[model samples]
Target: MQFQKKEQYRRQEIWELVKGKEEKISRNFQQSGYERIDDNLFAFVNIGYQGHAGQAFPNQYDTDTERLLWYGKKETHSKQPLMKRLIDGAITFYCFARWNDDPNFTFLGTGKLVNYRDNFTEVFNKDGTQTFCLELEFDLGDNSIHPAWINNFDASFEAEPPDTKEGKEKYVRHKTRERDPAVVKAKKDEFQKEHGRVFCEACGFDFKKTYGARGDAFIECHHNVPLHSILGETQTKTSDLTLLCSNCHRMVHRKKDWLTLPQLKSLMERN
Candidate 1:
């Protein structure tokens, strides 16, 4: 989803705009709508699914659109900023996917949630009127593609919870390999040496040795989607990569609130 910060707008207005007329907008729907493969056999796989929804906001904008921006306190409200609205839009899209009926569908990554504060900005217009537009953009293949699925054997409304623990145990993944800061750094360096020129794919920036006498510049490499399910016996190319900074990477993992790469970029510009 993408937006240009312009003026006061309601969360509902953005929601309505992104919530397409279709019942479900998934990759499966894109590849091939509901179809019968054989007798008693039907498949609905929407790999390109992103969820979005509304959260808590007490203070409401009196504008006709009912737009309002609230901080920690719900009642005290103001105009919703473009960045927040865009993130909310991405969240809404991701949230809606929970209702999809595809056995081989997963979100951008581990299907985890992320949360962060939106940074706002004000741009002036020719009429001397200030307009705030929300901006957002993402590379779906990297951020939202995973091995998560939703299945309905009887076409029922019930959704069976996934075996998260079992999947983890069966995968035989090295938990430490994935999380150890040293391991992450070493692997990143290795990839850079072999690939040549370490830079963020989403936003170009080289690794910095230090910053503010405290930190260094670092780039994160993320699979545009997940790799395990599509890993063995088949190799995906580098084009299937989405690189991000620490901040952007964390935001990508926002559970209840998130934004795509494109969406995130849009928000940054507006801010």
Candidate 2:
């Protein structure tokens, strides 16, 4: 299908098209700077200005994989800036690539930013001034492209997941179950009773000890039991939960293989 331009559509408006649908409509969707990587993966290319030697900003793509290393614009420096929202692991980006013939973009596919790094590299601008760039990596979930859509692109490809050893190490961490607030509270109380304070089991980081009054009673609860292992509607036992600091909790979910408490503890020791 040929790419079309929607002069009136914004990112939010485009998201509405596939919000609740099981399959996205192949046609009728278009965004600039989006490129099709595979059946399920697409990239939103942020090429620097065409006036410069770099077509859009310079970027690198692994020909053998669905890894597109992209750079952010040069203007911002805030710690938690708006651009950071794109890599926050919450928003699902409907990627698009700019059309060479016109100032339009084509809708590629959907994905989520799995990882990112700031101050990744410095680039010399046309004006001879240097700017730091933020690098981002995205993962395509189950949103595969339609067969008809593949005909419109050059060739269809599949983004490979991690290798055997790496895949085995990475936990399928997406599945989760809702525990009752009472059960969560009970877990915390029991941990406090035994240890005299709630602290990160993996890192031994004590919130109250570090943050004083404001951090007291402020530890996070993590579900130790794998959600998929439970048959059905199983009661959450106190032993099924553990205490974690926000940092540790985030680290546990940072990769596909969710780290067990023991694994994280070992990682800390090695470091």
Candidate 3:
């Protein structure tokens, strides 16, 4: 309850800041998820608010990074106007993206378009429990953007607002480096060093030394859990790894919601 009360005050502060900031918002758009591959970082989810009609796109830190690694249509071309609208608070939606399967990770709801000047240090909560205050500014006021299946879930669509120091952080949060090439390269190198010698748990495959039919049979490492759950934490283990081929690994993160390797295995078994 204390957290909730804090969130309220935070929202009031954000509203006050934006009351007369008057800036023109654009019109063409789309939103998507952003991820930092090497660190296995789930890109921050960004929400776009447009006068009254806003939608969220998964954050894709950079077009090139997203194009090179992620499997979706990277060149689909997003509407810049839409992105600006959402960021500027003309539209409001719960635009969040996360990996639900990793046991080692926790869930977080994040987005781009931060409040004033992207001052994350002053806005986030102490324990970093959640970002409730940031979301209240564009509160849909009893509107539900989630699908029907999730409509009944008890998430706050509209509440008094967040006022906590933690709630305040949302306004200052930005994607940081949604697609930092340096960060990605470093992460990849780290993963290789730690997992290069390890074998795959599912098939005893070796990724570091060899390839498969495509070439050497190197083992594939998996997060076992989602990165969003592990954000702000350091040191992940290779033992929590699963060895699969490129195909299997791709299939693993496909669903993004309630999708897990074990669950995939179950589906395979039934078939």
> In model 3, what is the error at residue 186, expressed in angstroms?
16
- For model 1, residues 1-271, the per-residue Cα lDDT tens digits are 4433222222333333455555344443344322221111111212223323222212112223322222222111122432233222222222111123333322221111122232222323345454443212222223332211110011111223332321122222112001112323444556677767555544555555334323233456444443222322333344544556655655665443445678777777888
- Candidate scoring better on TM-score of 1 and 2: 2
The whole-model C-alpha lDDT of candidate 1 against the native structure comes to 0.33
Candidate 3 Cα misplacement greater than 4 A, ranges = 1-214
The sequence of per-residue lDDT tens digits that candidate 2 reaches over residues 1-271 is 1223323334334444434345553442344233222222234454334533553456544334444456655643324423433433222355554434344444434544444566754666677777776666544333443322221111221222222320122223222223255555666678889989878888888878999988886676666654434554566677877778777776775554568989888888999
Candidate that beats the other on TM-score, 2 or 3, i.e. the better one: 2
Q: Which candidate's TM-score is highest?
A: 2
lDDT by residue for model 3 (1-271), tens = 1112112222222223333236321121112233222212222233222211222322222322221111112322112333233332223233222333111221222222222222122122345442322121211122422221111111321223323321112222333111112222233345557766444444444644465443332333444553323444344444444545555555554433424666767766777
* C-alpha positional error of residue 19 in candidate 2 after TM-score superposition, expressed in Å: 24
TM-score (C-alpha, index-matched) for candidate 3? 0.29
**lDDT-sorted candidate list, best first:** 2, 1, 3
The predicted structure with the larger lDDT, 2 or 3, is: 2
